[model samples]
Target: MSTGAFSDTGLFVCFEGGEGGGKSTQSRLLQQWLEADGHEVVLTFEPGDTEVGKRIRQIVLSPETGELSNRTEVLLYAADKAEHVDTVVLPALRAGRVVITDRYVDSALAYQGAGRTEAVAEVEAVNRWATRDLRPHLTVVLDLAPQAGLGRFEERDRIEGESLEFHQRVREAFLAMAAADPDHYLVVDARGSIEEIHAVIRARVAAMLVTA
Candidate 1:
Protein backbone atom coordinates (compact mmCIF):
# COMPACT_ATOMS: atom_id res chain seq x y z
CA MET A 1 0.00 0.00 0.00
CA SER A 2 1.40 3.35 -0.96
CA THR A 3 1.49 5.70 2.01
CA GLY A 4 0.67 8.42 -0.49
CA ALA A 5 -2.91 7.16 -0.52
CA PHE A 6 -3.38 7.59 3.22
CA SER A 7 -3.87 10.92 4.88
CA ASP A 8 -0.91 10.22 7.20
CA THR A 9 2.68 10.18 6.05
CA GLY A 10 3.66 6.86 7.61
CA LEU A 11 2.87 4.25 10.24
CA PHE A 12 4.07 3.68 13.80
CA VAL A 13 4.80 0.15 14.95
CA CYS A 14 6.48 -0.93 18.18
CA PHE A 15 8.15 -4.14 19.26
CA GLU A 16 7.82 -4.81 22.98
CA GLY A 17 9.16 -7.60 25.16
CA GLY A 18 10.96 -8.42 28.39
CA GLU A 19 14.72 -8.91 28.56
CA GLY A 20 16.07 -11.97 26.74
CA GLY A 21 13.05 -11.95 24.48
CA GLY A 22 14.13 -11.47 20.86
CA LYS A 23 12.89 -7.89 20.63
CA SER A 24 16.16 -6.43 19.36
CA THR A 25 16.69 -9.08 16.69
CA GLN A 26 13.09 -9.03 15.54
CA SER A 27 13.04 -5.23 15.52
CA ARG A 28 16.04 -5.23 13.20
CA LEU A 29 14.47 -7.79 10.89
CA LEU A 30 11.20 -5.89 10.69
CA GLN A 31 13.00 -2.67 9.85
CA GLN A 32 14.93 -4.41 7.11
CA TRP A 33 11.79 -6.05 5.76
CA LEU A 34 9.87 -2.80 5.72
CA GLU A 35 12.68 -1.01 3.92
CA ALA A 36 12.96 -3.87 1.42
CA ASP A 37 9.27 -3.45 0.67
CA GLY A 38 9.99 0.16 -0.35
CA HIS A 39 8.82 2.05 2.70
CA GLU A 40 11.08 4.69 4.22
CA VAL A 41 12.11 3.37 7.65
CA VAL A 42 13.53 4.74 10.87
CA LEU A 43 14.82 2.33 13.53
CA THR A 44 15.06 3.75 17.02
CA PHE A 45 15.20 2.41 20.56
CA GLU A 46 14.29 3.46 24.06
CA PRO A 47 17.05 4.82 26.28
CA GLY A 48 16.96 6.64 22.95
CA ASP A 49 18.86 8.55 20.36
CA THR A 50 19.05 11.91 22.17
CA GLU A 51 21.94 13.19 24.27
CA VAL A 52 19.85 13.37 27.41
CA GLY A 53 18.57 9.96 26.54
CA LYS A 54 22.11 8.59 26.35
CA ARG A 55 22.96 10.00 29.78
CA ILE A 56 19.71 8.65 31.22
CA ARG A 57 20.34 5.31 29.58
CA GLN A 58 23.70 4.95 31.28
CA ILE A 59 22.21 5.83 34.64
CA VAL A 60 19.25 3.47 34.34
CA LEU A 61 21.05 0.50 32.83
CA SER A 62 24.09 0.64 35.07
CA PRO A 63 24.08 -1.80 37.98
CA GLU A 64 26.76 0.15 39.78
CA THR A 65 24.11 2.20 41.55
CA GLY A 66 23.35 0.38 44.79
CA GLU A 67 19.56 0.33 44.75
CA LEU A 68 17.19 2.55 42.81
CA SER A 69 13.72 3.15 44.21
CA ASN A 70 10.82 2.00 42.08
CA ARG A 71 9.19 5.37 41.59
CA THR A 72 12.48 7.03 40.79
CA GLU A 73 13.23 4.35 38.26
CA VAL A 74 9.79 4.78 36.76
CA LEU A 75 10.15 8.53 36.49
CA LEU A 76 13.55 8.21 34.86
CA TYR A 77 12.21 5.88 32.24
CA ALA A 78 9.32 8.24 31.59
CA ALA A 79 11.69 11.16 31.27
CA ASP A 80 13.70 9.31 28.68
CA LYS A 81 10.49 8.45 26.83
CA ALA A 82 9.23 12.01 26.79
CA GLU A 83 12.47 13.25 25.29
CA HIS A 84 12.53 10.36 22.81
CA VAL A 85 9.01 11.05 21.57
CA ASP A 86 9.71 14.73 21.18
CA THR A 87 13.03 14.24 19.39
CA VAL A 88 12.69 10.97 17.54
CA VAL A 89 9.35 9.23 17.06
CA LEU A 90 7.05 12.13 16.27
CA PRO A 91 9.33 13.58 13.61
CA ALA A 92 9.74 10.25 11.83
CA LEU A 93 6.00 9.74 11.73
CA ARG A 94 5.48 13.24 10.37
CA ALA A 95 8.06 12.64 7.64
CA GLY A 96 6.30 9.55 6.24
CA ARG A 97 8.60 6.86 7.53
CA VAL A 98 7.67 3.54 9.04
CA VAL A 99 9.01 3.99 12.57
CA ILE A 100 10.20 0.79 14.24
CA THR A 101 11.22 1.12 17.84
CA ASP A 102 12.94 -1.69 19.71
CA ARG A 103 11.16 -0.50 22.80
CA TYR A 104 8.58 2.22 23.36
CA VAL A 105 6.23 3.73 25.89
CA ASP A 106 4.98 0.22 26.53
CA SER A 107 8.29 -0.83 28.06
CA ALA A 108 7.90 1.71 30.81
CA LEU A 109 4.30 0.61 31.18
CA ALA A 110 5.36 -2.95 31.73
CA TYR A 111 8.71 -2.66 33.45
CA GLN A 112 8.01 0.43 35.51
CA GLY A 113 4.29 1.13 35.31
CA ALA A 114 2.71 -2.06 36.50
CA GLY A 115 5.68 -4.22 37.40
CA ARG A 116 8.16 -2.19 39.34
CA THR A 117 6.54 0.58 41.41
CA GLU A 118 4.04 3.06 40.03
CA ALA A 119 0.38 2.31 39.35
CA VAL A 120 -0.41 1.23 35.80
CA ALA A 121 -2.99 3.96 35.35
CA GLU A 122 -0.62 6.61 36.61
CA VAL A 123 2.17 5.48 34.34
CA GLU A 124 -0.11 5.41 31.34
CA ALA A 125 -1.59 8.77 32.27
CA VAL A 126 1.80 10.41 32.28
CA ASN A 127 2.67 8.71 29.03
CA ARG A 128 -0.50 9.97 27.40
CA TRP A 129 0.34 13.51 28.38
CA ALA A 130 3.93 13.20 27.25
CA THR A 131 3.13 11.75 23.86
CA ARG A 132 0.11 13.97 23.35
CA ASP A 133 -1.95 10.80 22.85
CA LEU A 134 0.29 9.40 20.11
CA ARG A 135 0.28 5.61 19.94
CA PRO A 136 1.55 2.88 17.73
CA HIS A 137 -0.66 1.53 14.97
CA LEU A 138 0.50 -1.97 15.93
CA THR A 139 2.42 -3.25 18.95
CA VAL A 140 3.95 -6.66 18.44
CA VAL A 141 4.61 -8.16 21.86
CA LEU A 142 7.15 -10.96 22.06
CA ASP A 143 5.85 -13.22 24.82
CA LEU A 144 7.90 -15.88 26.51
CA ALA A 145 8.14 -17.25 30.05
CA PRO A 146 9.69 -14.63 32.30
CA GLN A 147 12.38 -16.99 33.54
CA ALA A 148 13.24 -18.02 30.03
CA GLY A 149 13.51 -14.43 28.99
CA LEU A 150 15.60 -13.38 31.97
CA GLY A 151 17.92 -16.31 31.51
CA ARG A 152 18.87 -14.95 28.12
CA PHE A 153 19.43 -11.54 29.67
CA GLU A 154 21.90 -12.65 32.32
CA GLU A 155 24.88 -12.67 29.97
CA ARG A 156 24.21 -9.11 28.93
CA ASP A 157 25.16 -6.13 31.04
CA ARG A 158 22.29 -4.17 32.56
CA ILE A 159 19.19 -4.21 34.77
CA GLU A 160 18.13 -7.65 33.64
CA GLY A 161 20.15 -8.48 36.74
CA GLU A 162 17.10 -7.58 38.79
CA SER A 163 15.40 -10.21 40.94
CA LEU A 164 13.41 -13.01 39.31
CA GLU A 165 10.21 -11.79 40.95
CA PHE A 166 10.70 -8.36 39.44
CA HIS A 167 11.04 -9.83 35.96
CA GLN A 168 7.88 -11.88 36.51
CA ARG A 169 6.01 -8.69 37.25
CA VAL A 170 7.26 -7.31 33.95
CA ARG A 171 5.87 -10.30 32.07
CA GLU A 172 2.54 -10.06 33.84
CA ALA A 173 2.28 -6.38 33.04
CA PHE A 174 2.88 -7.02 29.35
CA LEU A 175 0.24 -9.76 29.27
CA ALA A 176 -2.29 -7.53 30.93
CA MET A 177 -1.70 -4.71 28.44
CA ALA A 178 -2.16 -7.06 25.51
CA ALA A 179 -5.33 -8.50 27.02
CA ALA A 180 -6.80 -5.09 27.49
CA ASP A 181 -6.10 -3.84 23.97
CA PRO A 182 -6.58 -6.75 21.63
CA ASP A 183 -7.16 -4.51 18.64
CA HIS A 184 -3.85 -2.66 18.65
CA TYR A 185 -1.68 -5.39 20.15
CA LEU A 186 -0.75 -8.87 18.99
CA VAL A 187 1.06 -11.32 21.24
CA VAL A 188 3.57 -13.54 19.51
CA ASP A 189 5.18 -16.61 21.06
CA ALA A 190 8.85 -15.69 21.06
CA ARG A 191 10.24 -19.06 22.13
CA GLY A 192 10.91 -20.17 18.58
CA SER A 193 13.77 -19.86 16.09
CA ILE A 194 14.69 -16.36 14.92
CA GLU A 195 13.70 -17.07 11.31
CA GLU A 196 10.33 -18.42 12.37
CA ILE A 197 9.63 -15.43 14.53
CA HIS A 198 10.60 -12.98 11.80
CA ALA A 199 8.36 -14.79 9.35
CA VAL A 200 5.40 -14.42 11.67
CA ILE A 201 6.14 -10.72 12.19
CA ARG A 202 6.47 -10.15 8.43
CA ALA A 203 3.09 -11.77 7.78
CA ARG A 204 1.42 -9.66 10.43
CA VAL A 205 2.91 -6.44 9.11
CA ALA A 206 1.80 -7.30 5.57
CA ALA A 207 -1.74 -8.00 6.71
CA MET A 208 -1.90 -4.84 8.73
CA LEU A 209 -0.75 -2.74 5.79
CA VAL A 210 -3.35 -4.33 3.54
CA THR A 211 -6.12 -3.71 6.03
CA ALA A 212 -4.95 -0.17 6.69
Candidate 2:
Protein backbone atom coordinates (compact mmCIF):
# COMPACT_ATOMS: atom_id res chain seq x y z
CA MET A 1 0.00 0.00 0.00
CA SER A 2 1.41 3.39 -1.00
CA THR A 3 1.47 5.95 1.80
CA GLY A 4 0.93 8.71 -0.75
CA ALA A 5 3.65 11.33 -0.18
CA PHE A 6 4.47 12.18 -3.80
CA SER A 7 4.81 15.95 -3.74
CA ASP A 8 2.86 18.87 -2.41
CA THR A 9 2.40 19.36 -6.13
CA GLY A 10 0.63 16.74 -8.25
CA LEU A 11 2.48 13.82 -9.72
CA PHE A 12 2.18 13.40 -13.46
CA VAL A 13 2.42 9.95 -15.01
CA CYS A 14 2.30 9.23 -18.74
CA PHE A 15 2.34 5.98 -20.71
CA GLU A 16 3.84 5.71 -24.22
CA GLY A 17 3.85 2.90 -26.73
CA GLY A 18 3.07 2.09 -30.33
CA GLU A 19 -0.47 1.04 -31.20
CA GLY A 20 -1.63 -2.24 -29.56
CA GLY A 21 1.04 -1.96 -26.90
CA GLY A 22 -1.72 -1.77 -24.29
CA LYS A 23 -1.13 1.82 -23.13
CA SER A 24 -4.84 2.56 -22.76
CA THR A 25 -5.55 -0.64 -20.86
CA GLN A 26 -2.64 -0.24 -18.49
CA SER A 27 -3.36 3.42 -17.85
CA ARG A 28 -6.91 2.59 -16.82
CA LEU A 29 -5.73 -0.27 -14.63
CA LEU A 30 -3.24 1.96 -12.86
CA GLN A 31 -5.83 4.62 -12.27
CA GLN A 32 -8.27 2.11 -10.84
CA TRP A 33 -5.66 0.59 -8.57
CA LEU A 34 -4.56 3.97 -7.30
CA GLU A 35 -8.07 5.16 -6.62
CA ALA A 36 -8.91 1.92 -4.92
CA ASP A 37 -6.07 2.72 -2.56
CA GLY A 38 -7.73 6.01 -1.65
CA HIS A 39 -5.76 8.37 -3.86
CA GLU A 40 -7.20 11.16 -5.99
CA VAL A 41 -6.83 10.27 -9.67
CA VAL A 42 -7.35 12.12 -12.92
CA LEU A 43 -6.93 10.09 -16.11
CA THR A 44 -6.47 11.99 -19.35
CA PHE A 45 -4.89 11.64 -22.76
CA GLU A 46 -2.90 13.68 -25.26
CA PRO A 47 -5.02 15.23 -27.94
CA GLY A 48 -7.02 15.19 -24.77
CA ASP A 49 -10.72 15.12 -23.99
CA THR A 50 -11.07 18.87 -24.34
CA GLU A 51 -12.85 20.55 -27.24
CA VAL A 52 -9.68 21.59 -29.06
CA GLY A 53 -8.11 18.27 -28.30
CA LYS A 54 -11.07 16.45 -29.83
CA ARG A 55 -10.78 18.50 -32.99
CA ILE A 56 -7.07 17.78 -33.32
CA ARG A 57 -7.68 14.16 -32.40
CA GLN A 58 -9.81 13.76 -35.49
CA ILE A 59 -7.12 15.31 -37.66
CA VAL A 60 -4.33 13.15 -36.28
CA LEU A 61 -6.26 9.92 -36.28
CA SER A 62 -7.93 10.32 -39.63
CA PRO A 63 -6.06 8.52 -42.40
CA GLU A 64 -7.83 10.76 -44.85
CA THR A 65 -6.04 13.73 -43.35
CA GLY A 66 -3.45 12.65 -45.92
CA GLU A 67 0.27 12.94 -45.54
CA LEU A 68 0.40 15.89 -43.17
CA SER A 69 3.78 17.56 -43.21
CA ASN A 70 5.93 16.68 -40.22
CA ARG A 71 6.24 20.20 -38.93
CA THR A 72 2.57 20.84 -39.46
CA GLU A 73 1.49 17.81 -37.44
CA VAL A 74 3.97 18.58 -34.70
CA LEU A 75 2.72 22.13 -34.42
CA LEU A 76 -0.89 20.96 -34.22
CA TYR A 77 -0.02 18.47 -31.50
CA ALA A 78 1.87 21.14 -29.61
CA ALA A 79 -1.05 23.49 -29.82
CA ASP A 80 -3.36 20.83 -28.40
CA LYS A 81 -0.80 20.15 -25.68
CA ALA A 82 -0.54 23.77 -24.61
CA GLU A 83 -4.28 23.93 -24.04
CA HIS A 84 -4.29 20.49 -22.42
CA VAL A 85 -1.59 21.40 -19.96
CA ASP A 86 -3.05 24.74 -19.00
CA THR A 87 -6.68 23.73 -18.69
CA VAL A 88 -6.41 20.18 -17.40
CA VAL A 89 -3.05 18.86 -16.23
CA LEU A 90 -1.71 21.87 -14.33
CA PRO A 91 -4.89 22.42 -12.41
CA ALA A 92 -5.04 18.77 -11.38
CA LEU A 93 -1.46 18.96 -10.17
CA ARG A 94 -2.04 22.18 -8.29
CA ALA A 95 -4.91 20.53 -6.50
CA GLY A 96 -2.56 17.65 -5.59
CA ARG A 97 -4.37 15.02 -7.65
CA VAL A 98 -2.42 12.29 -9.43
CA VAL A 99 -2.57 13.08 -13.14
CA ILE A 100 -2.24 10.03 -15.37
CA THR A 101 -1.95 11.10 -18.97
CA ASP A 102 -2.23 8.52 -21.77
CA ARG A 103 0.45 10.34 -23.70
CA TYR A 104 2.61 13.46 -23.39
CA VAL A 105 5.32 15.49 -25.11
CA ASP A 106 7.45 12.38 -25.33
CA SER A 107 4.88 10.94 -27.71
CA ALA A 108 5.36 14.00 -29.89
CA LEU A 109 9.11 13.57 -29.69
CA ALA A 110 8.78 9.92 -30.60
CA TYR A 111 6.06 10.01 -33.26
CA GLN A 112 6.36 13.39 -34.97
CA GLY A 113 9.83 13.88 -33.58
CA ALA A 114 11.16 10.69 -35.12
CA GLY A 115 8.66 9.99 -37.88
CA ARG A 116 8.93 13.53 -39.17
CA THR A 117 12.70 13.50 -38.65
CA GLU A 118 12.17 16.78 -36.85
CA ALA A 119 15.44 17.81 -35.27
CA VAL A 120 15.43 16.84 -31.63
CA ALA A 121 16.54 20.31 -30.67
CA GLU A 122 13.64 21.84 -32.56
CA VAL A 123 11.20 19.37 -31.08
CA GLU A 124 12.55 20.04 -27.62
CA ALA A 125 12.27 23.79 -28.17
CA VAL A 126 8.62 23.55 -29.20
CA ASN A 127 7.78 21.12 -26.37
CA ARG A 128 9.44 23.36 -23.77
CA TRP A 129 7.29 26.30 -24.73
CA ALA A 130 4.17 24.17 -25.04
CA THR A 131 4.50 22.22 -21.81
CA ARG A 132 6.64 24.73 -19.94
CA ASP A 133 8.88 21.77 -19.10
CA LEU A 134 6.26 20.23 -16.86
CA ARG A 135 7.95 16.84 -16.72
CA PRO A 136 6.13 13.75 -15.57
CA HIS A 137 7.29 12.09 -12.37
CA LEU A 138 7.13 8.72 -14.16
CA THR A 139 6.74 7.71 -17.79
CA VAL A 140 5.93 4.12 -18.66
CA VAL A 141 7.01 2.92 -22.10
CA LEU A 142 5.59 -0.45 -23.16
CA ASP A 143 8.20 -2.03 -25.42
CA LEU A 144 7.16 -4.38 -28.20
CA ALA A 145 8.33 -5.15 -31.72
CA PRO A 146 6.97 -2.85 -34.38
CA GLN A 147 5.71 -5.67 -36.57
CA ALA A 148 4.04 -7.49 -33.71
CA GLY A 149 2.39 -4.37 -32.40
CA LEU A 150 1.30 -3.27 -35.81
CA GLY A 151 -0.04 -6.72 -36.54
CA ARG A 152 -2.17 -6.57 -33.45
CA PHE A 153 -3.58 -3.24 -34.44
CA GLU A 154 -4.22 -4.36 -37.97
CA GLU A 155 -5.80 -7.51 -36.69
CA ARG A 156 -8.23 -5.40 -34.76
CA ASP A 157 -8.70 -3.20 -37.85
CA ARG A 158 -7.76 -0.29 -35.63
CA ILE A 159 -4.31 0.73 -36.71
CA GLU A 160 -4.89 4.20 -35.35
CA GLY A 161 -4.97 4.30 -39.15
CA GLU A 162 -1.19 4.61 -39.26
CA SER A 163 0.84 2.76 -41.87
CA LEU A 164 3.17 -0.08 -40.95
CA GLU A 165 6.28 1.96 -41.72
CA PHE A 166 4.99 4.87 -39.66
CA HIS A 167 4.41 2.61 -36.68
CA GLN A 168 7.94 1.27 -37.05
CA ARG A 169 9.40 4.74 -36.88
CA VAL A 170 7.28 5.54 -33.82
CA ARG A 171 8.62 2.43 -32.06
CA GLU A 172 12.19 3.44 -32.74
CA ALA A 173 11.57 6.93 -31.42
CA PHE A 174 10.15 5.63 -28.15
CA LEU A 175 13.17 3.37 -27.64
CA ALA A 176 15.46 6.34 -28.16
CA MET A 177 13.59 8.37 -25.56
CA ALA A 178 13.91 5.55 -23.04
CA ALA A 179 17.66 5.28 -23.65
CA ALA A 180 18.10 8.99 -23.09
CA ASP A 181 16.13 9.07 -19.84
CA PRO A 182 16.29 5.74 -18.05
CA ASP A 183 15.81 6.86 -14.49
CA HIS A 184 12.38 8.42 -14.84
CA TYR A 185 11.22 6.01 -17.54
CA LEU A 186 10.46 2.32 -17.32
CA VAL A 187 10.47 0.27 -20.52
CA VAL A 188 8.33 -2.78 -19.94
CA ASP A 189 7.72 -5.85 -22.07
CA ALA A 190 4.28 -5.71 -23.69
CA ARG A 191 4.27 -9.24 -25.06
CA GLY A 192 2.86 -10.81 -21.95
CA SER A 193 -0.78 -11.43 -21.19
CA ILE A 194 -2.64 -8.31 -20.14
CA GLU A 195 -2.81 -9.43 -16.53
CA GLU A 196 0.91 -10.17 -16.41
CA ILE A 197 1.78 -6.86 -17.99
CA HIS A 198 -0.48 -4.96 -15.65
CA ALA A 199 1.06 -6.80 -12.73
CA VAL A 200 4.46 -5.34 -13.53
CA ILE A 201 2.95 -1.91 -14.04
CA ARG A 202 1.00 -2.12 -10.81
CA ALA A 203 4.08 -3.09 -8.87
CA ARG A 204 6.13 -0.31 -10.42
CA VAL A 205 3.56 2.40 -9.73
CA ALA A 206 2.83 1.07 -6.26
CA ALA A 207 6.51 1.23 -5.36
CA MET A 208 6.70 4.77 -6.63
CA LEU A 209 3.66 5.67 -4.58
CA VAL A 210 5.13 4.10 -1.44
CA THR A 211 8.44 5.92 -1.78
CA ALA A 212 6.96 9.07 -3.22
Candidate 3:
Protein backbone atom coordinates (compact mmCIF):
# COMPACT_ATOMS: atom_id res chain seq x y z
CA MET A 1 0.00 0.00 0.00
CA SER A 2 2.97 2.30 0.50
CA THR A 3 5.89 3.02 -1.79
CA GLY A 4 8.51 3.85 0.87
CA ALA A 5 9.85 7.19 -0.31
CA PHE A 6 6.48 8.58 -1.45
CA SER A 7 4.63 7.47 1.66
CA ASP A 8 4.77 10.85 3.36
CA THR A 9 5.27 13.28 0.54
CA GLY A 10 2.77 14.80 -1.92
CA LEU A 11 -0.46 13.15 -2.91
CA PHE A 12 -0.64 10.88 -5.98
CA VAL A 13 -3.91 10.85 -7.87
CA CYS A 14 -4.71 8.77 -10.94
CA PHE A 15 -7.61 8.66 -13.38
CA GLU A 16 -8.34 5.26 -14.85
CA GLY A 17 -10.94 3.91 -17.25
CA GLY A 18 -11.27 2.29 -20.65
CA GLU A 19 -10.71 4.25 -23.85
CA GLY A 20 -12.90 7.37 -24.42
CA GLY A 21 -13.87 7.43 -20.74
CA GLY A 22 -12.81 11.07 -20.45
CA LYS A 23 -9.81 10.43 -18.21
CA SER A 24 -7.74 13.05 -19.99
CA THR A 25 -10.35 15.76 -19.51
CA GLN A 26 -10.94 14.94 -15.86
CA SER A 27 -7.20 14.71 -15.16
CA ARG A 28 -6.63 18.13 -16.67
CA LEU A 29 -9.52 19.63 -14.75
CA LEU A 30 -8.19 18.21 -11.50
CA GLN A 31 -4.73 19.52 -12.27
CA GLN A 32 -6.05 22.99 -13.00
CA TRP A 33 -8.15 23.04 -9.88
CA LEU A 34 -5.28 21.89 -7.69
CA GLU A 35 -2.92 24.48 -9.12
CA ALA A 36 -5.43 27.28 -8.71
CA ASP A 37 -5.78 26.27 -5.08
CA GLY A 38 -2.03 26.93 -4.70
CA HIS A 39 -0.87 23.34 -4.91
CA GLU A 40 2.12 22.39 -7.02
CA VAL A 41 0.70 19.96 -9.58
CA VAL A 42 2.41 17.70 -12.07
CA LEU A 43 0.19 16.42 -14.86
CA THR A 44 1.46 13.37 -16.69
CA PHE A 45 0.33 10.11 -18.33
CA GLU A 46 1.46 6.54 -18.79
CA PRO A 47 2.98 4.96 -21.92
CA GLY A 48 4.17 8.32 -23.25
CA ASP A 49 5.47 10.49 -20.45
CA THR A 50 9.15 10.01 -21.31
CA GLU A 51 11.28 9.47 -24.39
CA VAL A 52 11.45 5.73 -23.76
CA GLY A 53 7.77 5.68 -22.93
CA LYS A 54 6.94 7.40 -26.20
CA ARG A 55 8.50 4.56 -28.13
CA ILE A 56 6.81 1.98 -25.97
CA ARG A 57 3.50 3.73 -26.40
CA GLN A 58 3.91 3.64 -30.15
CA ILE A 59 4.75 -0.03 -30.12
CA VAL A 60 1.84 -0.95 -27.88
CA LEU A 61 -0.84 1.18 -29.52
CA SER A 62 0.18 1.26 -33.13
CA PRO A 63 -1.99 -0.98 -35.25
CA GLU A 64 0.97 -1.34 -37.55
CA THR A 65 2.88 -3.12 -34.79
CA GLY A 66 0.41 -5.98 -35.34
CA GLU A 67 -0.49 -8.90 -33.13
CA LEU A 68 1.75 -8.77 -30.08
CA SER A 69 1.62 -11.66 -27.66
CA ASN A 70 -0.13 -10.95 -24.37
CA ARG A 71 3.17 -11.35 -22.53
CA THR A 72 4.92 -8.90 -24.83
CA GLU A 73 2.16 -6.31 -24.48
CA VAL A 74 2.11 -6.43 -20.69
CA LEU A 75 5.90 -6.31 -20.44
CA LEU A 76 6.05 -3.22 -22.66
CA TYR A 77 3.49 -1.55 -20.45
CA ALA A 78 5.47 -2.49 -17.32
CA ALA A 79 8.62 -1.13 -18.84
CA ASP A 80 6.89 2.20 -19.38
CA LYS A 81 5.68 2.22 -15.78
CA ALA A 82 9.14 1.50 -14.38
CA GLU A 83 10.66 4.44 -16.21
CA HIS A 84 7.68 6.69 -15.53
CA VAL A 85 7.70 6.10 -11.79
CA ASP A 86 11.44 6.56 -11.49
CA THR A 87 11.57 9.74 -13.53
CA VAL A 88 8.27 11.62 -13.59
CA VAL A 89 6.18 10.39 -10.67
CA LEU A 90 8.73 9.96 -7.88
CA PRO A 91 10.51 13.22 -8.52
CA ALA A 92 7.25 15.18 -8.53
CA LEU A 93 5.96 13.50 -5.39
CA ARG A 94 9.28 14.03 -3.60
CA ALA A 95 9.07 17.72 -4.44
CA GLY A 96 5.70 17.79 -2.70
CA ARG A 97 3.81 18.27 -5.96
CA VAL A 98 0.34 16.86 -6.45
CA VAL A 99 0.93 14.24 -9.15
CA ILE A 100 -2.04 13.54 -11.39
CA THR A 101 -1.77 10.95 -14.12
CA ASP A 102 -4.11 9.91 -16.92
CA ARG A 103 -3.55 6.21 -16.33
CA TYR A 104 -1.58 3.87 -14.09
CA VAL A 105 -1.02 0.23 -13.21
CA ASP A 106 -4.73 -0.43 -12.99
CA SER A 107 -4.98 0.07 -16.74
CA ALA A 108 -2.62 -2.81 -17.34
CA LEU A 109 -4.37 -4.98 -14.79
CA ALA A 110 -7.76 -4.34 -16.30
CA TYR A 111 -6.91 -4.18 -19.99
CA GLN A 112 -4.44 -7.06 -20.14
CA GLY A 113 -6.25 -9.19 -17.63
CA ALA A 114 -9.56 -8.89 -19.42
CA GLY A 115 -8.86 -7.96 -23.01
CA ARG A 116 -5.71 -9.95 -23.58
CA THR A 117 -6.77 -12.92 -21.39
CA GLU A 118 -3.79 -12.62 -19.08
CA ALA A 119 -4.18 -13.50 -15.39
CA VAL A 120 -5.05 -10.44 -13.33
CA ALA A 121 -2.82 -11.42 -10.43
CA GLU A 122 0.11 -12.00 -12.72
CA VAL A 123 -0.33 -8.65 -14.49
CA GLU A 124 -0.67 -6.90 -11.16
CA ALA A 125 2.49 -8.50 -9.83
CA VAL A 126 4.46 -7.30 -12.83
CA ASN A 127 3.13 -3.78 -12.45
CA ARG A 128 3.79 -3.70 -8.70
CA TRP A 129 7.41 -4.55 -9.34
CA ALA A 130 7.62 -2.03 -12.17
CA THR A 131 6.26 0.78 -10.03
CA ARG A 132 8.00 -0.29 -6.84
CA ASP A 133 4.52 -0.82 -5.36
CA LEU A 134 3.61 2.85 -5.69
CA ARG A 135 -0.14 3.38 -5.66
CA PRO A 136 -2.33 6.37 -6.10
CA HIS A 137 -3.65 8.00 -2.96
CA LEU A 138 -6.88 8.42 -4.93
CA THR A 139 -7.95 6.67 -8.13
CA VAL A 140 -10.88 8.26 -9.94
CA VAL A 141 -12.57 5.82 -12.27
CA LEU A 142 -14.82 7.40 -14.88
CA ASP A 143 -17.18 4.50 -15.17
CA LEU A 144 -19.17 4.07 -18.37
CA ALA A 145 -20.73 1.27 -20.32
CA PRO A 146 -18.21 0.02 -22.84
CA GLN A 147 -20.51 0.62 -25.78
CA ALA A 148 -21.33 4.15 -24.72
CA GLY A 149 -17.70 4.98 -24.01
CA LEU A 150 -16.34 3.54 -27.24
CA GLY A 151 -18.95 5.39 -29.24
CA ARG A 152 -17.27 8.65 -28.30
CA PHE A 153 -14.13 7.85 -30.20
CA GLU A 154 -13.96 8.33 -33.96
CA GLU A 155 -10.83 6.25 -34.43
CA ARG A 156 -9.72 3.25 -32.45
CA ASP A 157 -6.22 2.48 -31.22
CA ARG A 158 -5.01 -1.11 -31.22
CA ILE A 159 -6.44 -1.71 -27.78
CA GLU A 160 -9.59 0.19 -28.55
CA GLY A 161 -10.25 -2.00 -31.55
CA GLU A 162 -10.90 -4.97 -29.27
CA SER A 163 -14.26 -6.71 -29.33
CA LEU A 164 -17.24 -5.41 -27.35
CA GLU A 165 -16.94 -8.42 -25.09
CA PHE A 166 -13.35 -7.52 -24.36
CA HIS A 167 -14.27 -3.98 -23.41
CA GLN A 168 -17.13 -5.19 -21.24
CA ARG A 169 -14.72 -7.38 -19.38
CA VAL A 170 -12.33 -4.51 -18.89
CA ARG A 171 -15.11 -2.37 -17.46
CA GLU A 172 -16.05 -5.08 -15.02
CA ALA A 173 -12.44 -5.51 -14.01
CA PHE A 174 -12.19 -1.81 -13.15
CA LEU A 175 -15.39 -1.88 -11.15
CA ALA A 176 -14.24 -4.95 -9.26
CA MET A 177 -10.93 -3.32 -8.40
CA ALA A 178 -12.66 -0.18 -7.17
CA ALA A 179 -15.19 -2.19 -5.18
CA ALA A 180 -12.41 -4.04 -3.41
CA ASP A 181 -10.71 -0.81 -2.35
CA PRO A 182 -13.51 1.69 -1.83
CA ASP A 183 -11.50 4.07 0.31
CA HIS A 184 -8.87 4.68 -2.35
CA TYR A 185 -11.15 4.90 -5.37
CA LEU A 186 -13.94 7.17 -6.57
CA VAL A 187 -16.07 5.55 -9.25
CA VAL A 188 -17.98 8.19 -11.17
CA ASP A 189 -20.71 7.65 -13.73
CA ALA A 190 -19.26 8.90 -17.00
CA ARG A 191 -22.76 9.36 -18.35
CA GLY A 192 -23.04 12.59 -16.41
CA SER A 193 -22.23 15.96 -17.92
CA ILE A 194 -18.60 17.08 -17.85
CA GLU A 195 -19.28 19.84 -15.34
CA GLU A 196 -21.19 17.49 -13.08
CA ILE A 197 -18.38 14.96 -13.12
CA HIS A 198 -15.74 17.60 -12.51
CA ALA A 199 -17.72 18.99 -9.57
CA VAL A 200 -17.82 15.59 -7.95
CA ILE A 201 -14.10 15.05 -8.60
CA ARG A 202 -13.27 18.49 -7.19
CA ALA A 203 -15.27 17.85 -4.05
CA ARG A 204 -13.58 14.50 -3.43
CA VAL A 205 -10.10 15.93 -4.12
CA ALA A 206 -10.85 18.94 -1.93
CA ALA A 207 -11.65 16.65 0.96
CA MET A 208 -8.42 14.75 0.32
CA LEU A 209 -6.40 17.98 0.35
CA VAL A 210 -7.90 18.99 3.67
CA THR A 211 -6.86 15.68 5.22
CA ALA A 212 -3.44 15.82 3.56
Query: Highest TM-score, which number?
Result: 3
Clashing pairs in 3: none
TM values, all candidates: 0.91, 0.90, 0.96
Worst 10 residues of 2 by lDDT: 1-10
lDDT of 1 by residue, 73-164 (tens): 77787888889888888888889888988888788888777667678778777766666667888889999887888676436545687677
Sorted by TM-score (best first), the order is 3, 1, 2
lDDT of 1: 0.81
Tell me which of candidates 2 and 3 scores higher on lDDT: 3
Tens digit per residue, CA lDDT, model 2, 1-212: 11122335877899998877889999999999899999899999988478999998888767667677778888988999999988999899999899999989888887777766678678867976898678888889998887777666433322356666777888888888788778678899999888998898788788888887
Clashing residue pairs in candidate 2 are 5-212
RMSD of 1: 4.3
RMSD (Cα, Å) of model 2: 4.6
lDDT of 1 at 43: 90
Worst 10 residues of 3 by lDDT: 1-10
Q: Give the TM-score of candidate 2.
A: 0.90
